[model samples]
Target: MRTPVDDFQPGFAGRRSSVAGRNVTILFLSALTIMAGATISPALPAIEAYFADTPEAAILTRLVLTVPALFIAFCAPFAGLLADRYGRRKVAIVAILLYGVAGVSGVFADSLFTLLAGRALLGVAVAGVMTVATALVGDYFSGPARDRFMGQQAAFIGIGGIFFLTGGGLLAEFNWRAPFLVYAVAFALVPAILAFITDVHRPEALPKQEDRGLISGFFLTIPLAAVLLASVLNSLTFYLMPTQLPFHLKALGTNSPVLVGVAIGACTLASALFSFFYGHVRRRLDVSAVFALGFGFLAGGLALVAAAGSFAAILPASFLVGSGLGLIMPNLGSAAMAIAGEDNRGRVAGLLTASIFLGQFVSPLVSQPIAERTGYAAVFGLGAATLLMAALVALGLAGLRSRRQPA
Candidate 1:
């Protein structure tokens, strides 16, 4: 966007650029992005049971988990604008503080509606933290450095997802309220952020030659549109495990939260492992090829899930899906960064974040009806079909682009 100028900048030096300090802070905060929806996933069945007497309890209980995603989709773009106008550090600090407060408030809510309200507030908090955290990555690093850093960050989030989902399952074994305690961890991040993280540029100032037109131009490009479309479909299918797997496990004759958590957590673990090596994968493959590989794995995994008869089968299926996500997540993020310059990084990151969560929010809506009619297994079949189509589309597009390029 800055007229193709050199990517590096003369950033803040001294303690502000201490790699270890800032990386630790950002990695810790990145975990919060997963917390918005996944932390409560292990307890979904229990929550539904608690409110069983209420009208439409099944749907509303699922809403309790996904409602935050809906709010995040709506609020993140505005949050990005705020971070751009205000300092990123300031917005992030406030957001983290609110995240803890709203996240923990779920423990004391007397009814489903009260908890829904708290979840909605948690979404607003997540929008700010997520947008600012990703924008900071762009602000702090560039080129191959940025690619490696994004992969590392994706690994952290995947690992965090594993921890939170498994811990939530164990906590739900005692009571539904117990998992809310994990939200308190956000409070500990505040001081660390204040001491370590610093803004890369002055608030509201654009780098030279980084015209507003270029920002708009980048957003309208075909590559960005393809990345976002793939991201949306990928998220919608990936989320099926988290949002509906518990119910599926229940239908399979096991109601133990630990087993359900382990089933879903397997995907996260695989994703983390793949993300840790994403840099190596990226060195050999272009973005579209990576996407094609990812979707192919996703398709195969979903097919396995659709036919799965036991937890053992689901475990391997989850791993395959996770592997695909590992390939897709970091590449999509870095692709966004490649298109955006510093001036619009926050806004672009916000839009990307919004697309991801919006798919999550819609996952249940799309799956619920099919699940209600045919059963949960049908949902996986649908996901498999969707992902297979996506893979074909990606590969075809890649072939076309390759042919069009000058040799």
Candidate 2:
């Protein structure tokens, strides 16, 4: 069997010398997934007001923020297949170029439908970027290195969210379209990608006679399925903050875009801090233990959001939510990458990406009606209850796994 070391071509020693550059490049690439939604979240209210005359303006405005996720959910599997068949580098570069074009097109949109169309194309770009970026992480690192890198990757994304969300909020003060300009940053990363990333080769896949479907090959595994489920749930719950929090804050009589940015940035800040420590935490706890811990934090945070009477109360709740997500994000990536083999890393990465984004797309669909009927507090309370149940399940599973282990 070819080791990760042998998967690289010649001149790898020179590449190894610049590992920091390579890691930074990929880390920024990973941040693009978070940026896809976050950079525009602060502008959501502004966009809604701007297009108030449009039918279903409220739902359609939220869709502007989440439509990319729907596209990512659909296109990521195909992106993974392409990466596996051709190369990560080629697909990533093309995606980055497309990301800049589609993302910026929102600034020129005259109608809600035009903006949604651009956002859908942006989603296609993100599917490729997110899939290949993750596959590259798996390709480039293994074992403890992979764990540490996953933690750092999550941290970087959180940090990026701080800047993007805060900046978007500030920019929205000028014009709803101002936030769309941030997507232009994607173009700057193309040069870094070219400088630091190299494609890793894998052995040819199994014969046609032996091959099962890609989804069946990985999804059928209990551990992988559990990880993907966790990802989906985690994303669904985390996204509630972005998709609903602004409206929640507005309902509480605090509607400033900057304050909205700060509130969400507080969550990202906590996520970054906790994510920085994930590798250390992973050393002591198994993935199940981490999941239990993360879900516990999420439950507490959402419960706090449910109970909060003022905008100030939401800040600490945001921190708690961020803390839980910080741990869960890296854990999901590490666990999924550990389960995937070299040959199918791209496909596994793609599916994982799909699950994560799918939950984002579904968040508003699930929470909006609940919020509309019972109010935002009830929606948050329901999320807290659901997460609490998930935490208990994780703890139970952890105990069962421990008892099954040979002494």
Regions more than 4 Å wrong, model 1: 1-17, 207-218
> What is the model-wide C-alpha lDDT for candidate 1?
0.85
Judging by TM-score against the true structure, name the best candidate.
2
Find the number of clashing residue pairs for candidate 1: 0
Best-matching candidate per lDDT: 2
Please provide TM-scores, in order, for all candidate models, with all chains considered together: 0.94, 0.96
Q: Model 2, which residues run further than 4 Å from truth?
A: 1-3, 12-17, 203-213, 216-219
**lDDT, candidate 2, 1-407, per-residue tens:** 45464557557435656677888899999999888889989999989999999999999998898889999999998898888777888999999999999999999999999999999999999999999988988988888778888999999999999999999999999999999999999999899888878787443444554244456544448889899899999989888899999999999998999999999999999999999899999998888999999999999999999999999999999999999999999999999899987667888899999999999999999999898999999989989999999999999988998899899
The whole-model lDDT of each prediction reads 0.85, 0.90
Please report, as a residue range, the 10-residue window in candidate 1 with the lowest summed lDDT.
1-10
Tens digits of per-residue lDDT for model 1 on 1-407?
33222333334334445657888888888889987777789999999999889898898898888888898889887787777667689989999999999999989988899999999999999999988888888887777777787889989999999899999999999999889889999999999888777777455456545544314445646877777787789889999998888898789887998888898889989888888888888887778888889999999998998999988889999999999998899888888878875667777878888888899899999999999999999999999999999999888877887888899
